[model samples]
Target: MPKAKKKNRRKKYNYNVDRKKLNRAFRKRQAPRIKCSQIRHAWDRTKSVSQNLAEMGLAADPNKAVPIPKFMQPVMKMDIDGPEKKSKIVQKPYVLNELEYQASLPEKQSQTLSRDLIDYVQHMIQNHGENYKAMARDEKNYYQDTPKQIKSKINVYKRIYPEEYQAFCTSLQQEKMDKQ
Candidate 1:
């Protein structure tokens, strides 16, 4: 009979490393403990607002107290509704030339295509529907984008956000049903 093979026992590896010790290993040194007291006994019994004021020598007297300050007392003495004050009309300091005035005036703001093509397409569908040409012709829809670009953007928006497009189509159908 052949001799039996020798049995070898493997040692168990421990992966339970101390996290706190590991964190402090790379640090400058062990941090100093907080000097503040966790439980404060001095503030256990607190004083009221009136008692605090009296202690600071700022106690107010009700009899001598005025609702308005002395500075505002003079302004309040004048009656607002008594009579309107007379004033002279001031003339223009310099006459404006037509050309200079025109040049100085703010330029008209031009509309730019929105980054959110989905919203733009949804708005166009609600307002314009399948009439791509008429939609492009509208001032609100134009916004630097040509008819072809607008159509392409609409197609892209539909492909990317199918759920929103489906909802929009359903809403339109419901509107038509309601109208009928």
Candidate 2:
């Protein structure tokens, strides 16, 4: 049997260098160059460094460069006898009193549940006792919570208000005794 002839699939490569086209392409891709003299001329002695940079279309933080006034600059003091003498006075560290420290601190925020949620928990407990499944199926269970979720809420209520929970249990017991 005769073998089939394979077709040439190689791409044609250009070896010629076009200097004019290369230079034009490079110029188009390059950023606009700024001379040192241009920058010096654009800068204002009265204005801040950031302001000058911003006016020249450069990214600079407004607060980064703060210009100090001539009067605010510290003057070099010369001693007649020798070099500059340092001040002997030492500053004492400030100490806050207990009451003052307490007053300065932020007040604690309440993280307890809302009055409505607390009431709902109390209602559920009164109606269903320890039966979380019954609580979950209750008519007042508007959230349609699972038995596990109902039990968790009840546990939270008991943990948060131990005294109130104890009082509630005693009241239920008293009612049961009265019935008997």
Candidate 3:
């Protein structure tokens, strides 16, 4: 065979580019006609939705809220009534479901209620039996949630269980943080 033609070396191709200029090209191009302030104002109108976006890790925008120092706010305080009285007077101490308590309220009377206390009373009647059996059940759950047993539970812990509620809150906060 005739001498093979000398192999030609492949020429190296280069795509050298300036990073800054490339980045500028890739960056989001703003509609020059749209004013930045007007865009910001439009975003402000969606404050709640935007806040949720940050919560969902969809945005880096800082929250527009003042941080309340932990010390500034008192630990939670639950206004617990006496065990017996609480059963008779408060929302069912052993409420199995929060939704059910809400559902039990009369469609209209629940609305007429001017304050939370009235709404609570309505909840109590449903959770605790309206009669003696209900009262007994109420007493049982009240004691379960607290230390004092039965009527004593009611009489001894007549004040709101601010400490107990606070403890529960701390536990919940810790649990949430752990989940995070």
Candidate 4:
């Protein structure tokens, strides 16, 4: 059998290839030729970055350019003082006193009862003489502008008929007064 042919090393075959220039050309090809202004217009019209990119004639797979929002934290422009270092961010404990929390929050006024209506309801509850529930139901059905007009009228009826509301304080007062 013939001996295996040795690989011929030729000086003419050696040539200097500039990797930097080749890499630069490759990067240029990868970059879009579209103008920045056109891209901006597309973004402005769509009101979104990815949506604008989609219309800008770039072959973009949304899955590639940007990851799913759920998997990613919001991008924040944090200045790096040194080399990239990550520290666990601990959330501050929510310490709230009952009074503080209540004070901080908005106050909720009674829906149907005004200050006058509340007094009227108390009076009706105290007397313990009539069916205020029916009257209340009627007022609720008939009256419109609450906390101002209708609310007061409804309370007056409640004063005449306390049983309608099932208000416990009214029942106790009626017993205390020997009206029950």
Instruction: Quantify all predictions' global Cα lDDT against the true fold.
Output: 0.61, 0.72, 0.43, 0.50
**TM-score rank, highest first?**
2, 1, 4, 3
Instruction: Report the error of model 4 at residue 127, Å.
Output: 5.1
Please give the distance, in angstroms, between residue 145's alpha carbon in candidate 2 and its true position after superposition. 0.7
Task: Indicate which candidate wins on TM-score.
Answer: 2
Q: Pick the lDDT winner.
A: 2
Candidate 2 backbone overlaps, count: 0
The local distance difference test score of model 2 is: 0.72
What's the ranking of the predictions by lDDT, best on top? Answer: 2, 1, 4, 3
lDDT tens digits by residue: candidate 2, 1-180 = 766556455666666978789898898576344445456655566777565665555436644345455685568855588767453221211212333566699987455877888899999988889899899899999999999998899898888788888998899889889989
1-180: candidate 3 lDDT, tens digit per residue: 766565566766556968778666665352123243323333423357545333333333444333345675667856577465322232222332333566697775222223453333334433452343455556434434322233343332223344543564476667679989
RMSD of each: 25.3, 18.6, 27.2, 24.9
Q: After superposition, how far is residue 26 of candidate 1 from its true place, in Å?
A: 18
lDDT of 3: 0.43
Badly placed stretches (over 4 Å) of model 3 are 1-15, 30-36, 41-49, 52-180
List of clashing residue pairs for candidate 3: 80-160, 82-154, 83-153, 83-154, 129-134
- The 10-residue segment of model 1 with minimum total lDDT is 36-45
Candidate 2: residue 142 lDDT (0-100): 99
Indicate the residue-level lDDT of 33 in model 4: 59
Lowest summed lDDT over 10 consecutive residues: which window, candidate 2? Answer: 87-96
State the lDDT at 104 in candidate 3: 92
For TM-score, candidate 3 versus 4, the one ahead is 4
